[model samples]
Target: MRAYERLLKYVSYETTSDESSETCPSSPKELVLAEALVEELKQIGVADAHVDKDGYVYGSIPATKGAENEKAIGLIAHMDTAPAMSGANIKPRIIKDYDGADIVLNEKLGVVMDTVTFPHLTNYVGQDLIVTDGTTLLGADDKAGVAEIMTAAAQIIEADAQAGEGSAHGKICIAFTPDEEIGRGADRFDVEHFGADYAYTVDGGMLGEIEFENFNAASAKVHIKGENIHPGEAKNKMKNASLLAMEFNSMLPPAEIPAHTEGYEGFFHLCGMSGDEENAHLDYIVRDHSMDKFLERKAMLERITAYLNQKYGEGTVTLNMKDSYYNMREKLESDMYIVDRAVEAMRENDVEPIIQPIRGGTDGARLSFMGLPCPNLSTGGHNFHGKYEYVCIQSMDKMVDIIKTIVRKSN
Candidate 1:
């Protein structure tokens, strides 16, 4: 099947990940799509196609004739859609040869994607654009990547069959992981079993988005233990933890935040804050590109706990810090061909590569730390993880070309 058809069919599955769950996949619905994709991979002539217990589908296409000894190239995409929106029964619309105007997604709901709000729509004039009906997310965030990999795998096999001896290709491996939206996609991933020299997750945004660098991440959870006393005479005795949480937030750099910083700028974003007089909590994710800034972000949190302890006795503020992921650029820089191949493939296919540091983390960021040295490629998607998500069918077709080029150009 074509990439567009594959995307439409895959999005039909309600594979929304759940962040609250403790399971590997975090949701049961992802298995529905995982099984379906395993069948699809086997139907496409993939050998040993199967979904593992952790809900990852892994398969391989053996190298052909002269390319048998070539390095293995892996292409990966996520099975679960983002947990931020609904992925149930998505109604996608195809606007053929778009006229460069506002797109009305739902007539009765008055939901539309205005060109004024999304000026990027102007770039897709006269191309096939697939949009949602404004009720649910389009799930194109990674399904577009999935379809592109599947289609490219089929094309590689077809080309080998048609070209006879020397024109086949290297070993191609593909995997569809689950719960990537919740940051657990790589937790159960078996890198050694996948057996690729390096890999690429086609999970980034836009057509030419190539991400080699991302923030080294750490999550901070602050717990404030307070003494709730009578409000009548509670000047020095009534220590409100809620007020302390606010004070903790105030200690961070006011200018350094996600909304205020971009492009190598580090920031401490307060994702959550809650509690009352007795207890309070603060959740933050610290991000930075530099190791020094990354360490400083962690140290800043530690300093806050120390300051609060000195003021309100020894064990008042408790901090729990956990490392999320690190910058993949350090590992990716060692082998720059992974990025160079993507840029060359985009240039050859009439798409200019947009090389930028991802403001957030991706599955590739963790995969790189896991010894794969993976980089990220684009899925030709925009406004992802929400109701306004859309995918360009023409760009999805071009992504197929990019993957095919990567397959043929593998050294």
Candidate 2:
């Protein structure tokens, strides 16, 4: 089956991960897709295909007789969709040969995807695009990756059956992870048991994109304490916590934010804020590609807290910070050949390699540090995690071929 066809079936299952949930898979619904994937793998001739207790689906295709000693290559993609948008009951429509004009996603909701707001629509003018309705995300973020990998596996098995001894290739390991959108995709991963020398995460955006560098991430929560007083009697004694929270945010560099930064630039994003007269809270996520700069950013948060405490009195502002993940480039630098292999595979499949740094983190970023020198590959998706999300059907088909080439050339 074509990758896009598989994607349509896969997205039918509601697999939106919950960050607030403390469970391993974050949501029990993810296991539904995980089990289905295992069944599909088994049907494709993988004897040991199964979903583990942690909701990770694993299966391996053994090497042909002559290629047994060659290096093992692994393909990885996540199963769960981001919790930022509704993943339930997604209504996807295909735009056959896009006309580079505004697309009315939902006439009733007055939702339109205009070329002026999303100029990248022109890039896929002559290509088929799978897009979401006005209500929900398309789930192409990694489902496209999942479908491409699964289709590649099916093609390899069919080729082996037809060729008898099969086209020369090494062992191919496949894994579909859960909760990647919430950043715990690799938390319980068993790298040693996966039995691959290296892996590639098919969780990136756009066609031909190969990412090895990602942000060094951290999360910060700031709390403010203030005394509430009646408005009529309030004077110099009243200290509003909500106003104090705004002051804390005003201390940050306005230009160094997600809206203003791009490429290699780092940012301090205020993800959420809540406040009242007595107490206030601010949640932020810090990101930088450079480790030194990442550390400096954390220190800057500490400095801000200290200065605020001095100005408002000690114990008034409380800051809590934690590191999320480091740049995978630090771990993959020594094993650069893995990245080169992907580049060659893309070129062999008639796709130009676009090596760029990921503005966001992927499961591969943490996996690389877990002794799996993994880089990231694109799923031919765009505008991930939102209703404007889409994927080029032509690009998804090409990605399947590219994945097949990557594994076959491993011999």
Candidate 3:
């Protein structure tokens, strides 16, 4: 079957991950898709295919006779969608030969994707685009990648079977991981058992993005306690924790936030906050491409917390900070050849390679630190994790060809 068909099938399983869950997969529904993938893998001639207890699916396409000595390479994509949006009951619509105009997702609700909001729509004017209704996300983030890899694997398996001995290039390993949206996708990954010299995550955007570096990330939480008193009798004795929370937020640099930063610049993003007069809470995510800057950003938060405590009687404010992942550039520097292979593969297929640093983290970033030099490849998706999410069918087909080219050229 074609990659687009497979993608539509995969997205129908409602695999949105949960961030608050403590389970390995983070969500029980992810296993439903994992088991389906195992069945598909076995049907495609990958005899050793199975889903681990943690909901990670692993499969291998063994090398043909004479190519057994070639190094094994892995292809990976996550199975879960981000928890930021609803992935359930997704109603996808196909636009054949897009007209480069505003797309009306929900006519009654007045949900429209205009040119002003998403300029990238103009780029795919004459292509087949798969989009979603305004109510639910399309789940194209990594489902497109999953479909591309599956289609490529089927082709490789068929070619090798037809040619018999001494025909295929090398062993190709494929893995479908869960909970990447919550940053636990690589926590239990078995790199040694995967047995690949290198790997590529088909988990990027656009048609030719090849990313090896990503942001160094950390999460921070702030809790504040205040002395609440009746407003009518309030004087200097009353301390409002909600007002203190706002003051703490004001202390951060106004320009150094996610909305104002781009490229290699760093930012402190306030993801959520809730509170009242008695107590308040703040949640933030700090990110930077440079380790020194990353550390400085975290320190700045701690410094702010210290000053607040000193002013509010030493126990009014508390801070909790923890590192999530680091930049993969330090680990990938020695393995430039892996990046070159992907670039060459893209160029060979008439696709221009756009090499850039990722503003966000991927499963490959954490896996790289764990003894695997993995880079990211594009899955032909755009505007991921929202209702505007979409993928180009032609671009997905090109990605399948690029994966095949990478495997053939690497061997």
For lDDT, the strongest prediction is: 2
- The most accurate candidate by TM-score is 1
180-281, model 1: which lDDT tens digit per residue? 999899999999989888789999888998899998999999999999998998987998999988888899999999899989899999999889999999
At residue 202, candidate 2 shows an lDDT of: 96
State each model's CA lDDT, in order: 0.89, 0.92, 0.91
CA deviation > 4 Å runs, candidate 2? 164-166, 227-244, 276-278
User: Candidate 2 on 1-411: residue-level lDDT in tens?
Assistant: 899999999989999999999998999999999999999999989888999999999999998768888889999999999999999999899999998999999999999999989888899999999999889998998899999999999999889878754377889999999999998999999999899998999988889999999999999999999889998898987889999999999989999999999999999999999999999999999999999999998998899999989988899899999888899999989779889999999998888999999888878989998889999999999899999999999999999999988888453
Query: Looking at model 1, which ten-residue stretch has the lowest summed lDDT?
Result: 160-169
The deviation in Å at residue 196 for candidate 2 is: 1.5
Give the TM-score (vs. native) of candidate 1: 0.96
TM-score for candidate 3 = 0.90
lDDT of 3 by residue, 1-411 (tens): 889999999999999999989998988999999999999999989999999999999999887777788778899999999899999998889999999999998898888989888898899999999999998899988899999999999888887879844336778899999998888889999998788888999999999999999999999999999989999888988889999999999999999999999999999999999999999999999999999999999999999999999898798999999898889998998769889989999999999999999999988999999988899999999989999899999999999999988887353
Return the TM-score for each candidate structure. 0.96, 0.92, 0.90
